[model samples]
Target: MLFRIKSFFNLKTKAKYGLPLVLMALITSQTNAQDNRSFQIFQFPANKIPTIDGNSEDWKIVPENYIVGMDQLWDDSGKQPKADPKNLAVSVKIGWVKGLNRLYFLYEAYDDYWDFSLPGLHNDTFELIVDADQSGGPFIDRFHPNPNLTNTMDAYFSYHGVHAQNYHIFTPAVEKDWTMVWGSQPWIKNLPYANASYKYDFKPGQGGKLTLEFWITPFDYAGNNPSRAVESILEENKNIGLCWAIIDYDDVNKTENNGFWNLSKEHKMYGNASYSLPFKLMPLEKQYKKEIDAKWSFKVVNMAKREVAFVDESEGEITSWNWDFGDGTTSTEQNPIHQYKEAGKYVVILKIQGPKGISQLSKVWDVAVK
Candidate 1:
């Protein structure tokens, strides 16, 4: 139930009569119909969801496989300008998590300065361009006009003092003409289902670094609906196009500097291009099936009277545990203490349930009578 811009309302007539209630109802119903659509599946290796607090401690366990460096991006302005390495020498580590019907992003930007004073394209910002439908035709070109294109979406974010501002690009146009979906405040306070945080470094000598964490639904864009409600744009399409860029502004010369992580030279404009890399957002349940490998060790506390206590030191998310005391008796406690009537050589077995199904480990223990 994709709602094209033309089918919904006439842009010219919005000022005259505004959007009719009937048309609004139609768009909402179509968006709701997307619930039955299939979604792309992805399984993250970590179980703990990352907190969107501008701190990346939760991502320590995850691998930083996606690396976007400043050197890889092209100069769209064609100035052939040389930028200070101290400010431009930056890299970004990106990780994705899909949960609660929303997409989460963990971005770590390594830079020298964090500036947020300038306005429009002159400000230090992180930009994201996405093609929700992946229909390769009318791409987003900042310098060119392609009104026939409607699938691309763009977002520009900057941190200013205690709050952060997100500038959303409604159409495939240049940075100067792009409209701010959320108004007035320097911070993003009006977005319905979006949240983000950033940590900036102001210390000298050591390059400034920032950790940005945020989450948004696929339908959380201005083009989708005027209300900006949570919808399944990703689920409706299954595949999407994506690219990111880091913009740096030099206040001394009033010039713009840009760097990208995953964008191609042809599509290196300040907005999303229809002809870009494709990404599939899959369901977690389909990718969560695997056999768990059990690893554990134990410490035995002797009671000195044929009684001993066993402590479980295991890794991973263990749901249930089974312990065998070697004397034809068993217990379901994670760590259980067993007392034998007499001294003997016995084998202890531990069976645990984890993400990878069931696994067991065994060790030999000797008990002496006091």
Candidate 2:
């Protein structure tokens, strides 16, 4: 009894969570709550990963419940609770695959005024910030935790976007790169780090709906040196921080935004990782759930008594189970203790059945007691 208590307390956190204990402590200490509501990011099956080719067909498999509509956003610049759909409407869906350290986004928006005539920041844009590990703190040099350093060129390279990344994504980039990563590591906005595609028909200053598909790899530490940068590890049920804003300009000539629709309640989400809301990396939908696997283990309870204890350790839901002791005897109990008439090496098998299907496991001459 004491051994069991000690084992539970002494278990290594790193082995259980795939993160070291010290790093977990640092993450817990740095985190801040900007938004109370938690959002869910759909887990796309590896085969169903959306292609960044301006197509909506691939995202059809995602359910509507995952949509983050304009209703959820706060108009930080416009100071409106919700934008008039006739003037501006937006919907966003985020996705992730199990092993890939990348985030996929499908952005759909309708604007009464599409202003992208400018060569630079004057255009309509989607600004995004992500703290992949939810290791929250200031990401920009201006808000650097180290108070003394001048928010100069030196601090820009050393601290800015090192813990979190920011991207000013062009809604429909005309003659420019798709996005501008707001830090020293501009490389993060290109090729292997990111890709974007847009589907729109209207000319600059014309009104139309736009569909933009994009994917970006978020980093825990991204500096000028890509070789030394650390990409955040994405896993099931973990929470990350993400904030985005839609920057709109009614007229192409103006340098300021007509509206800024933000996913976060606070405007400072752009520079502070703490202000980015928690987005959970959810498990796959029911249709994509893994099937049950039959597994079991046995220990000799008493050699003189010819008794053994069997344990069922199957994965996934199971309604029923059957175990074969290879001693011409069987049991239906999930975990059973059985006594054999004679001592001998015996093959053991366990079978589990659930809604998905049935699974069976067999061991040959594995369990033995004398």
Candidate 3:
């Protein structure tokens, strides 16, 4: 009972329509076909897929609504300006349903061509930031898929030289429930730091995709001095994809590193897997609404004299505030203060919550004994 009433609708067109009736027809017909046949998976080389659409650069859909495509990780503009590197890839492609919020993302990240080129151990990083209605969202861990941490598919090294522990930083937000998602930022191992990687699934549509964009940046080392490397990567590769782009630096001049030749000639490893971003709409939404800026401001006074003893009623959005008057306990309030029981260097901390999120400030006060 194979009814091949094929018309002229493309995958992109079908996704755009997103009709319930159309979806039912697709599920019914496709499921029927699969039930009669044996299935096999086509494992591809690490760097590229097997085919491309003859009609367009767009990916063609397979029998199971499976569509995949790869481009040499382009610059911000989603245009391939260079050839795919043997040791690493700088491009990404994603396939998902129309109107659905969640989509699976396959990201390819690579670095220099050293013998130690291992996944998650290179000097490269990928970060995805989602903006909705022009506002920031909560900090979602884009690296881990589940609490079990079993699915470490986000990043993979070519040979095996990756190393690093994962960490999280808290921030403030104004847009309420705005999601700021990004992969781990790593340190480059060497000139041919070689290959590194990271990946994760995402909840989209619940927040709209128009405002979501990726910032492909490179940093020398993690520090406070506004690392020079960030600006360097941005200026050099601004032409990379904005919605989704491969963050590659070595191929800036569109030339592969000489070291790649040595690996190809000596190791008998000419082919590798290209990065693929196959997005799927996940039926999930965030559990908690984003908190106000971690920083907050309020007034503090002395109860005995009715005098404004410590007028900490500062003017600003304080998401979180901690006051320690040489005391062991701490309080997180808009405005907080402690009375001087004895004289000592009392440390005061104010975790300010603003549009940019949370920041902690500490000041030492010399409380004197009268």
Candidate 4:
């Protein structure tokens, strides 16, 4: 929930006690979304999930249309601020699985002068920002709920990336870790939340092509602890706000980067999520999907009365539905509410019919009650 911060404990207490429903509403609201929505995040089949090995063999199934090449990026920050393939060329491919709330990335790039000798942020980097639900606003520490705490470290701890996340991922990380999460919650970059692997044969300064594969979980409310964090649910056809920029340091001793190419036209996208480009989580390709298929999900309304709600999620043109509640009861309703008299564990079934064909699904012990 959007709580007005009055004191330090107020922010921590809200983060700790913020209800998921309200917090999710506050984080996922699209009131301010400026939909420059251009990219699609491909959905990989469950059996074809890509292994994070920094290899391109697994990503061959991804169509060429899903690629975002250097042509799409603008040099938002640089002396010349222009796209030049002679200096560097980069292409990015993104994918996601239906059940997993994570995004997989394959970054391929060739740079004439690959500079990453520094141990700090002074390196060739792929900077990214993701607002998984398109909840747009200043996520960084530029603004404050209370103006008095504007420049204080307390505000930095309480405000930076509370709704969105930014990552400065080194192209070929040297002695340092894979990325520097630009926020208070650095733990979000570790395993269970994120991972990375780089494949390259050249040294730090050598000019060559580099392949990097990684996956990260986007959160709407990622506080200090995972227990209170709210991971953004990935659903079909949802438009997420995402953008990236490349910070290329051609020379090791140069104080400034040679070029900064970003998918966004504005450089303020680093601190503002509203400036992020749109990325739709695309559904499975027709090649892997049935012309007509049956699917469903259930929500328990009240366990005390054994009341359950079933909703149809079938694919294609469905005309009718049949539901078997597994308690000597059945219904023809597309979505039905059923009540069980006495239940231990019961199997549920759903059947659907369309002009193309017919399909059915059965869940074993997916519904239970006292």
Candidate 5:
């Protein structure tokens, strides 16, 4: 019995004391590895984007209902197209891969009408060229045969020219990837685009999956801020705060109204940077027993400094919130209303929780204080 007891004591001593030290060493090593994992954008090597079937390419000529040689100034009083070709568009797809470092992009480009000019004179060959690691930066140009000109076999003339440009600058903490494309070159001026996109194959030091896709719509060119209409659409949602949307405008706040909001630091399955209403409106236990059919209710109000409190009770346990100053700023706190010291429209958002999960609601209210 004494010999068995001695062996058990030795085993427990080693496990209770030595095991934790080993775990600590392993965790510290992992932390150090994560601290050193950082990356920057190396120029994507230029390649000839092959045209498999020119006629059956993914792009639709004169997309968004804008046609060639037509008097469509802007998509709908927003931004104009870039050049005189009627419309400029590119459609791309990539085959899925197992890792983030290596990949391929298949793209197709088209003009407004393919060849809007000569009747039965429909011989238009296209070319896709990427100018990467250039003197300044990377550029993608779509080449087209000039309708009025000809080549060796009496085909239309073709040349490579960029309709838009894409480049990225990375800071140690924040990665800035930007793509600028125009709606119409000279015909419409207001709405040049900040491509609504980013590369999702990011290495956050940990092996994980990040994927994104964008839908680009070319609207009629509004002189210089074609994104104004898109902004208005976002404004309706009022989730524009802490976000950006790029266009040919000089507004600072409006700059972030476009692309995907990066939330990698949150360490969630899918990262998102958004606000939440963390309170609950529940019936008292006694009230619940007595009046099972009686409904429970609550309010949310905004009391932040120099901000207005606007409340929406269209849904959820959060019934109403007060706006102390009728300004666009708001909060999800019970009975919240606020007053602003300045005059301007503001974007407001709300979060509500239910038995299933949490949800977000947003709206933009224009407030002019007298």
Candidate 6:
């Protein structure tokens, strides 16, 4: 089942009739807090949990924040002045979702043609290069003269005709030579957890689109059993290095163009210094906590009979203060004393502005007439 974290700033208000609705909108916009040595990949929270059946319907509700364009490919030899016309015409949208303990991805590509007859990387394929540890150290370079597994994991999906196959390239800790692991494994699958169906569509004319979805667990390069439990990896690291690319075979036996998207300027055969981007994986609970903790704290004290003093205990710098005293009255003072004409219980809300963004707090105070 899909779980959603409610917005911390959206507080339920209890207001009497004929009063303007007291809306305290605390917008907590998250900035990329991780190191920005390379491009920072934002893992947007999924709204409509995708079924991973390759259908594009579920993705319709996802916000534009989760979508990025992969319309051009980097010239590896530095010979081509720009991405070839055959490749430039292709548009790719990449979406990411974090579920339970697994990471999900949806790759949608719009191309004029789709070729699956060629073998290996030469065919229509999607390559995912990941640095699970984000160590930024030595890794297995696919283009290296002696390519052996180091600290990188490469997953390749080749679509030929009606058949599709999955392949993984990594160097096992026990082995010195780089090993090419193929077929379905426990760690990786074409569908989300192998239970969902893979979706695909092809049109003969222009504006053809292809969509694919997959998921992966956490993997450790140094361990004997490299694939570790998702919980362990989450506990150890909050970010992972990732990059993706799409290979297009425009003509029947010729590799026409390669289009790259997100992370990296040049397509690194295995892993490149420019290829990996630090992707911050925020779980739902952590996200909620971060939003709630960013708020300010204030308390209400009975200054006198039928009167109360709102004390602002917020630290650091505050830009603005907005208070709604529930009795059709409001205040913008940092600390304001409000009086009640009649004995009753009222809900007091305070909205404060800070460096991170707006935050809110509320309390119910009882006023007694003298």
Q: Give the better candidate number (4 or 5) by TM-score.
A: 4
lDDT of 2 by residue, 1-370 (tens): 3344345435574467554664555444343232467899999998889989998999999899899998887677754556789889999999999889999999999999998877878888999999999988788888877778658778899989888999999888999998988889999988898889999999988899999999999999999999999999999999999989998788766667888888876688899888888899998898886688798888888989989999998879899999889988899999999998987889889989999899999998888878
What number of clashing residue pairs does each candidate have, in the order they appear? 8, 0, 58, 0, 44, 3
Q: For each candidate, what is the lDDT?
A: 0.50, 0.87, 0.28, 0.86, 0.27, 0.45
Q: Candidate 6 — what's its lDDT?
A: 0.45
Segments in model 2 whose C-alpha atoms lie over 4 Å from true places: 1-34, 79-81, 293-315, 318-357, 360-370
lDDT value, candidate 3, whole model:
0.28
Candidate 5 residue lDDT tens string, 1-370? 3354345446667577776665565565454334322211111112222222322232222123211112211222134433233233333332211112111223233233222121211212111111111122111112123434322222211111122212211111123222222212222211233222232232322222222222222221122233343111211111111111111111223322111111111111011111100111111223213211212122223333543434444333443333323244445464355566665555445555554445554445544343
What are the RMSD figures for all models against the true structure?
15.8, 13.6, 22.5, 10.7, 27.2, 21.4
Candidate structures ordered by TM-score, highest first: 4, 2, 1, 6, 3, 5
User: In candidate 1, residue 362 scores what lDDT?
Assistant: 84
lDDT per residue (tens digit) for residues 1-370 in model 6? 0111133222353223222332321111111123244332234455546665667676564445445454334545444456544543333333344434555565666566665533344445555565556545323323333334322243211111001112332101112111122322333432333332333455322235555654554333322222432221542227666665555445655555533333354344334423466566543434423432223234345534567776776544678788888788999988888887666777778888867677777766533334
Angstrom error at residue 162, model 6:
30
Candidate 2: Cα lDDT at 219? 97
Higher-scoring candidate on lDDT, 2 or 6 = 2
- TM-score, one value per model: 0.47, 0.73, 0.20, 0.86, 0.19, 0.47
lDDT of 4 at 319: 87
Q: What tens-digit string does per-residue lDDT give for candidate 3 at 20-41?
A: 6566766765653443211111
Q: How much is 176 displaced in model 1, in angstroms?
A: 17
Residue 67: error of model 2 in Å?
0.6
Native-referenced Cα lDDT, model 4? 0.86
Residues forming the 10-long window of minimal summed lDDT in candidate 2: 26-35
